[model samples]
Target: MILDSSLNITLDNSNNAVFRILGEERFKITNAGPDIGGRLQFSNGRYIHASVQDDPDVDELRFKASGHLDEPLRIYGGSNYNKRVGIGRLSESPSRPNEDMSRFGLDLQDTGNGYLYGLRLTNDTTGTGGSNGACIYYENSNMYVRNFTGGPIKFKTKGAQAMVIASNGCIGIGGITNPMYTLQLGFVNSNSGGAQRHANWNYLNSSNNSFKQLNGNYGNISIFVGGHISINGVIVCVSDKRTKTNIYPMNPVKSLDNLRLLNPVHYYYKDFINNPSQLQAGFIAQETKHVLPTSLEMAGQSIPNILASASYYVDSFKNKIIQFSDFDTSKLELDNSGNFYPYLRVFDEENDIELPYWITISKILSSNSIQIETKEELPSRVFVYGQYVDNFHLLHYHRVFTTFVASMKEVDAELQKEKLKTLELQREMNELISLVQTIQK
Candidate 1:
């Protein structure tokens, strides 16, 4: 029978009192204290129970959703004030409360171990029947939270929007605008106040140390780092001549002399003991430091500005090749000294008659016949080949040309001095002849 009014059973006469509901089972209580115990059957199979005990070794109170002993699962939420609830498989009715809470805040146990889930929402339905109905739905073991209507899921901090999952499912931080990519970190005032000019990403180590920073400071993007940087396992640096100023030419004689003083050794690094046969030819860093200290840094040694000048001259040679059609080959004809050099065959081994490396290599490759690209006969393939030939020859020719020009200059100075001596001897002979003529007269 449904009670329309409040029913209170006074325990004034008896220490233990029992109350019957639906005439099915009896609810008994022993003492009236902070502890309370009772059972309420809701429907045919479901029941809610609250049991309190005074014994120190027993559970103080236990609230349970109990059913048949063989029932596979049961879930019960105790009073919210107590801070614990349980949902699990229990074979027997709970005689004492399990006051343990798992790490995830739910006391879920099975024999000895069970997982505790903080929150679980499930929808048991098939096909499209549960679609467009709820935010969270479960199909067997899988669960999904879907926004059937076009709306955004926002995460906020201090009531300020921090991140947003938009209707189109793009996640955005700092701005709620739909992201163009899967994840977008937006900046406020991105188009104003120089905000767009700064680095977009930054990273720091545990010690708050920054190793590299990509910045846009001078209207160009560049990286700033503490030490030397490498790209793809190679050390590279930008050296655009146009970006440089205060340039001066190097005295090749002095540089070459300094280079010669640094003795190069054919040695292999002990670190590469496995590759002992790969011998390297280079000057030791300490030995080089004695003569060319400027080339030595903490990291390694490098060629000085001499290489830059050499590179500039190599580029000039390339320009000359590109404009070869404008060159007058007749300039190779005999000068006033009657000496003509159709091709300057620079040789090795210090043998004047020895074949030049360029000629020897050309004959070895069976490419001695040069196909020069002219303005009138500019074959694409020949132009490309000429470019490659110019680049290849320039590399080897520059060093030889340096020494050759130095030696040639010395020889030309001696020739000039000999010519002056010969003229002076002729003058002396004329003066002596005039003196003898005068004595005869």
Candidate 2:
């Protein structure tokens, strides 16, 4: 709202009212226009004007005509002019636009204080020639505006930079000043040397306040050291070594690369020429990357060399394990070597148990399709001797004696190797000691 001359204004039954002075209002709203129950009067030389807007139930501007209009009053916004001199309707206050984006509704201005408290100007048509076509300026200063019910301040940027509603002191919102905020979209903020939160993804051009959405290339919401921001959504946040932010862009892992790594070969039948120890049936190591047996030149073999013996291959183990349930009942295969292979799955479970033996498995075939299997106990539940993958029912038990014997064998092998090395070292030391003694004599 623009205030040029001095005037004594009295309004009745009005909603959001503001007293404009000089600088435009983009700070905040703390004014609800006088709730007049009688007629309104405007004194002094400056013309009495009002920009009345609002919904059907909301009285834009109303004045008791019976009251005397001893002064001239001009009503544009929701200003109630009973009978006054030089009474004229300047323009209607802008209102909430419809979905078609045809017209604009209201243009909020400062009422002396730095806030959008009351309606000062209204551009009805809101098209090319509407009064709301442009905007009012609100510099950063200590302006105070009050809201009756705290009607939300609105914004629409044709080519504006950023709309910063600022204030020196903490903003105050009366009941009416704060209206019903539904699933609508717009920018409402109060910049009191504090944070500036944009509504509907609004942004300001670093140069000026042309009030527009964040369209052109520029950074979005930012929080600084003295600044703290919080957003709740299906938000994607990222923090580098230094800065932390709620929004960033990352290239999603594409299936093209994963497809290249996937193999149609049976998961269990993977052949690893290198690290023959891990490839052995009972080998228990973690994280092995088996370059799924390709027809490529590797392990001293040409392209067509399917069998390369005496090759020192390195097969990195993986945490992947076979779950009996992963194999479709009809898909389970029994090879001619009397081995049944089931499909592997990606169930989350800790697998750290290791059995020393060859991890032998036994299956007993019953007459009525019942099957029981047993295995030498291993550290993890990776293989169920004879149980299906579901619910982890009972399989045959591991022989306690077999496990004990396996442990003993491992200990004996280590001891024998150490003993041989110790003997050889002792012999060498004795020879050195004899030579030292002869030299001394």
Candidate 3:
């Protein structure tokens, strides 16, 4: 029984009017209205109850009811709200549609019962529920609507009870709509609760955008006033997207336009200047300087100036080691009287690196013999180029040695001992020659 788009039928007379031919069985209307009204055409079809096809793909039944032949035709399932009495009169709001459309509308049976429905869209736009009404609402086991232009579907509940509104079994807005019962969206259990949640990829990255509806997963995911975002909610992502999951944010942080609204710094601004009460005690560290990030980028960071200065000094030390071959062994000699330091210099023809202009040894005793209690050596150039670290003005202690000459009038004790050793060695040689002459005789 292959039925393409070309199949057509007509019902003009009363008894044999409007017959639907299935595979082998032919179905005719058991009941009809008056003469002209009873007519049923394939294009303008009217049936007691349409036999909707069963399709798991669409989540609906196979046989179902069609609409009346009036100007604005409509269809409903076994749970049609048309027969149900309205709780109150449907009202209209000038600004936007009320969230409690069902309050002025139909009420389903007690829990443990539901219904199903099917709606095939042929033209660009169509309307159902009532011809001219405001808060028309319906509830069913499953509702399927497709093959139509893009016009948002609206559903309003009567009370703010914990009810779930869903799209395609998903609490998200946009994307493929699902047909299922127990569908819920955000949590607005009393005062006008709604969510414009958009699985719409374009709007997902933007703040203040929401998915308007949910298909299912009520207790699983709910959005409401004063509700904090869950730690790790369900990820809404497409198969084709690079990141197949939407658990974490894929976009950068600066996308936030109203960051102050979310996380405000000042509870209330204190005085203009120096107010002890205004300053937060815990936040002692102030933000010195920060590169304000753009609307959609992370804040950039620069090298700290203080740290850069320190690095410059360290690199200089390394370069000195490389330039001076003996810099590793050369020690620094500092004097306590004037805080003068004499450092070793490499005046080799190959390298002309300056030692500390003034070499003053202090504090530590060396391995040398006449343990001088304290030794201080100042470089003549100390007045010219100062030391490696300069907290104050530069020093050139090494320059003082250029015009100064050492007076050997009071020679060092170590030098006196070496001269005595030379004289003793001369006497020993003379005695040895005398012994050799006696042997010849």
Candidate 4:
């Protein structure tokens, strides 16, 4: 039978109906039984258009054209309005897509508020209209995953919930259930008969910042504002011999002399102006680095000293001057010479002290003779301690323990020598008294 100019229908030998359009097979309907269900097949790139109303003008579903076989079949909703695709039970009111309908299955809805999309999953086993499930939606420039059942959203791995995002926006790891803080971690301890051992990083408020174990006897580690860290337990450092290399003994006398050069001071941090009376006792990093240069650790890469091999001498005005024949004067312009200030110090051989001074470059008097002025008079022999990398010096204060022990040993040797001198003087005085007694007799 011919229905229109492009449409044609005929029955095959097995009584299966075949439909064609423009001489091409567009669809085929099989004469299978109801139990087997009659098959309806559409050719490639063909689609079925659907409409809610019988009116020919309203097409709620439209087909998208696909040029390749691998491209997925796309269905578009009606134009100029948002639409919802619902599977299983739906709400009585089709217009209110966001209504709480205690239905089972999924609903993907577009609310038409700037292309916002919502996906809701509901499970109402009791048949009562109590919506309880999860919803993943996008609104107001943010995507939200919400669970209306007041339960946590769990991420599972290896048959166990590895992480959970609580209803109150708290996060838990290692199978934690009721997280009391913003972030919590836990573990199921087999030794404790599956007890939950956990640590909480509580930053709920500015005044209550702490990271501590909740169910165990472990102490807390708190970091307060103003760069202060309070640890309730002793700090231990790894000092295994296997981890160390190039071991050598320090010279006790030299170590003692170097340690003596470090001057301990009682001072407060510049930022801690509110507590002026609260003094901290420690050696200055710069002074300690001068005393035990080997103990200093660079924060990052060590900067090579360009003037390390340069000869240093004091000018007529007692200003220190560094002379390097191969120095690059082009890099150091006279206008910006003051910005490249170098830290200079003189080792007084006779006085046995290091006098530190800052060298301000006044002029690039040639590559070899860069005229520099010091704040104070420098000693005869000048030494360059290298320029600051980023206007700061980082020193490892903990590495000075070996030098401190060596200094103690040097002090003990001095005490031993004083004891020997006292013993010899006492014996000589005894002999002199005996000689005086013999002459009197």
Clash count per candidate: 0, 73, 63, 0
TM-score of candidate 3 relative to the true fold: 0.15
lDDT of 1 at 219: 36
Q: Across residues 1-441, which tens digit of lDDT does each residue of candidate 2 receive? A: 433354334222354434423222111112433332222322321232232334322233322222433321222222232221222111232222222232223323344555442224343464341223323333464343322223324333564422222222222222112223222123333422322333233455568856554321323543322122354435443435466657543212322232244333323322332222242232111111232122111121111111111111112542222224232333333444645433221111244232233321132222212122223322333422221222221211122223334455656667888999999999999999999999999
Which numbered prediction scores highest in lDDT against the true structure?
4
Per-candidate local distance difference test: 0.39, 0.31, 0.29, 0.53
- Give me candidate 4's TM-score against the actual structure: 0.37
Tens-digit per-residue lDDT, 1-441, candidate 4: 445554545554544544433334334433321111111334444444333454433234333233532212222234322344333122222333334332222434354544233565575574331246666766777888767678888899988889899888888888777766678777555432333364344333456765433334343232213245566667666577887899888899998987878787888765352234477887777777778887665332112344333456776886557675455655542113446543333344445554554566666667556666766765544443334343244556666777788899999999999999999999999999999999999
Worst 10 residues of 4 by lDDT: 31-40
> lDDT score of model 2?
0.31
Best by TM-score: 4
Better of 1 and 4 by TM-score: 4
The model with the greater lDDT, 2 or 3, is: 2
Error of 3 at 225 (Å): 14
What's the lDDT for candidate 4? 0.53
Give the Å shift of residue 265 in candidate 1.
26
Off by over 4 Å in 2: 1-90, 93-104, 108-110, 118-441
Residue ranges of candidate 3 with Cα displaced over 4 Å: 1-168, 175-279, 282-287, 290-441
Estimate candidate 3's alpha-carbon lDDT, on a 0 to 1 scale: 0.29
